[model samples]
Target: MQVFKEKTLLKAAVKAAKSNAKIIGLVPTMGALHQGHLSLVKQALQECDQVIISIFVNPTQFDNPADLEKYPRTLEEDIRLLKQADPELWIFTPTAKELYGENISAEQFNFDGLEQVMEGKHRNGHFDGVGTIVKRLFEVITPHKAFFGEKDFQQLQIVRKLIDKTGLPVEIVGCPILREENGLARSSRNERLNTFEREEASFIYKTLLKVNELFGTKSAEYIQNWVEGQFKNHQVLKLEYFEIANTQTLEKINRKRKGNTYRAFIAAYVGEVRLIDNIALNNEE
Candidate 1:
């Protein structure tokens, strides 16, 4: 696999690939290769003639400096994993200076009211950072299709909006969330959890499953209260927020709309590591 740290060289290489009339697929990630990430790569391989994975720990997306600092940066291991996963995969590992130059600034992104709730409300400027880096990556790769995991459902939605707003000619492909055998959503941050905390973290997904099962019978308010109570039972898992909302607009729903789709969104802290998970409430028809 070829690795490129410079955009000029990466673009030149991608241009070469494009000259052959190959369908390009892009998977943008912050370099801690987990099954969750590889799933995107696997899907990309299935759909595209060529795949490129961008591994850059984007500083702009982190609201907390500590979280940014603690974010994993195992370049050697990441390379090793990608090599094992797919020998044909192209890796782009760019420095922040390469993408943003010496001065770093985030371009403000207004995703209607999508950016103002859940993760946006708690972690300020997070999505703008996400928008800035993903936009730059789209420009650099200019792939026909870009793959993202539905684990970050909100982020996936925001990215769809980004493509809409910028008129970028790239399809946003959302892959299903990969979970552990015990039901915990696969996340890079799960690495920081201790043994007990890791087990407790499974509660996040369990609660999501419970929400999905109870959706038809219980009211939204009742389901919210039920989830809050579940978190209270677990001392290590602190509740952040839970919402049963319209899947399209992401606004909290007081009553279930038969025609519209909805999902359960949850965010919580297991010890110091924050975890998020969501589940579909009903079939989207």
Candidate 2:
């Protein structure tokens, strides 16, 4: 339950953990703690000797300034929530200035077209922001393994690529997307939804399920068309982008290629809250 707000202090603590032959795990997050985040923390505690959860709401990751401003920050509550899970947890809660310096911005990267579609296509410079913050966290925390939810499947892939490109030692572990009883993917943004809007948000997952159901029988084009049509008729959520892509390259699957794995990805806006979710079209990850 100890919190380190300074990077140097956190680094020293991680160094101590390493010197003690402890296996360190990292669960980097932007605060606004919920069951979904706690799920990652729980897994880290299970697999590693020690876990560090970074709760900084990274500024450089948001392409929209207002979105950054509106992003939730519940540090005290978050700490209490984490303490309930593990009283000995080491929490890194760095400020923007403390972590990124006075002139905060993202470090650009070439993920070999991995950053050029879906979330990247609509929101300019978003992944770079994500990359910058995540890279910084890896540098400071120095975990043996880092955990991320599969809700941001693209980000997870980019992080895996980041490890390859930078040759970082930490393993990137992708966890399942924890959802509400209605099937709405658990997200920090879910806090913004009202009771009714929250229920309506379940449509995003339901649509993804429909896409999965239609996979082998329907063409990629047909699934894409059907998804668009579903959102068009829906009165609640506005579909942003839906793509059926190979799990590896993330290239949109036009026609079913033999021996290729696929996944269904979707992003939609339920009011101002933009939520994203994905489902594996097959049994594979």
Candidate 3:
């Protein structure tokens, strides 16, 4: 894989590929490639003639400076995995300075109602940073299609909205969340967990399953209380939020069975590491 750290060279490479009439697929990621990330890369390779994976730990997206500093960066191993996946795929791993330049000024973009709840409420300006950097990457790569994991279901929704609102000419594809044998969603942060913590971390997925079970028979209030109680009982995990909301709008649901579709999303802290996961409740039975 050709690794380009500069935007100019990466753009040139993409332009060259386009000139050859090759269909381009972009998989944007922060370094520390996990099975989840590789799933995205594999999907991109399946769909397009050329797959471009951009790995820049976007500093703008982090609400906490410490979180950004602590975020994993296993670049050597990440590239090794990418090379094994597809040796021909171009990997654009740029620095913050390369992508954002030296100014570092805060620019504003309105996300309508999408940015005010869940992750947005917990981590201030998190999605704005996400939107900003993603917009920049979308502009730079200009690929025919872009792939994102549904693990970050809200972020995927915001990205799709951003493309529609901005009229970006790239198809935003949301791939299914890849999980471990134990059902815990694979994430870069999973590397931070110790053996015991990893065992406890599986509770996040289990809690979601509990909520899913309670969806039709019980009220949202009951499900919410039960999920929250489990986190409290765990002691090791600090619950951030446990919500059942309209999957598309993300508006919190108070009553039960309002619609055919609902999403259960949770964000909790296992030690200093924050993890988020969601499950779609399709009441079709």
Candidate 4:
């Protein structure tokens, strides 16, 4: 795998695109490679002739400075992991200074109502920062297709909006959520959890599964209360927010429509490490 720290070098590397008609794919990530990330890489490898992976812990995306500070960075190990995933992968690892520079500014996005619910409601400016970095990278790479995990369901939606608003000639492919055998969603922050906390964290996904089970029979409010109660029983898992929302629009769904797709969205803290997970409700079949 070839690693480029500078955009100029990466751009030069991508110059091969001019001569060849091979489809380019991008998997933008912030280091700390895991099986979940590798799932995205695998899909890209299957579909695209070439793939580019970006590993920059975007400062603009973090709402809390402490969260940003605690964000994992294992570049050497990440490179090793990527090599195992695909030896021919083109990896981009740019510094904050290199990507953002001293005077950092992000372009504004009008996501309509897509950015005002769930994650957006809880974390301020989170999607804006996400939009900024994603927009910049999409511009820099200009790939024919980009892969994103459905683990960050809201972010995946916002990226779709980014493509629409910016008119970028790229397809946003949403891969399925990769989970552990015990049901805990694979995440970089999983590394921060202690043994007990890691096990306790599995409840988040368990509750999501429960939502899928109870969707047609129970009210959205009822399911929400049950999820909160489940977390309350386990003090280690601090429940932040849980909502049953329309999958396409992400607005809270009180009553299920006959054909509308819905999903259960969740965010909680296992110790200090925050984790998010979601499951399709009516659409599971």
The residue-by-residue lDDT of candidate 2 on 105-184, one tens digit each, is 78989999989988999999999999999998998888999999999999999999999999989999999999999998
lDDT string for model 1 (70-130, tens) is 9988999999999999999999999999999987879999999888888898999999999
Candidate 3 lDDT tens digits, 123-180: 8888888888888998998999999999999999999989978999999999999998
Candidate 2 stretches with Cα past 4 Å from truth are 283-285
Models 1 onward score TM values of 0.98, 0.97, 0.96, 0.96
Candidate 4 local lDDT, 121-152, one digit each (tens): 88888888899999888888888899999999
Q: Name the regions of candidate 4 deviating beyond 4 angstroms.
A: 283-285
What is the number of residue pairs that collide in model 3?
0
Overall lDDT per candidate, in order of appearance? 0.91, 0.91, 0.89, 0.88
Cα RMSD of all models vs. native, in order, equals 1.2, 1.5, 1.3, 1.4
Clashes of each: 0, 1, 0, 0
In candidate 1 the C-alpha lDDT for residue 17 amounts to 87
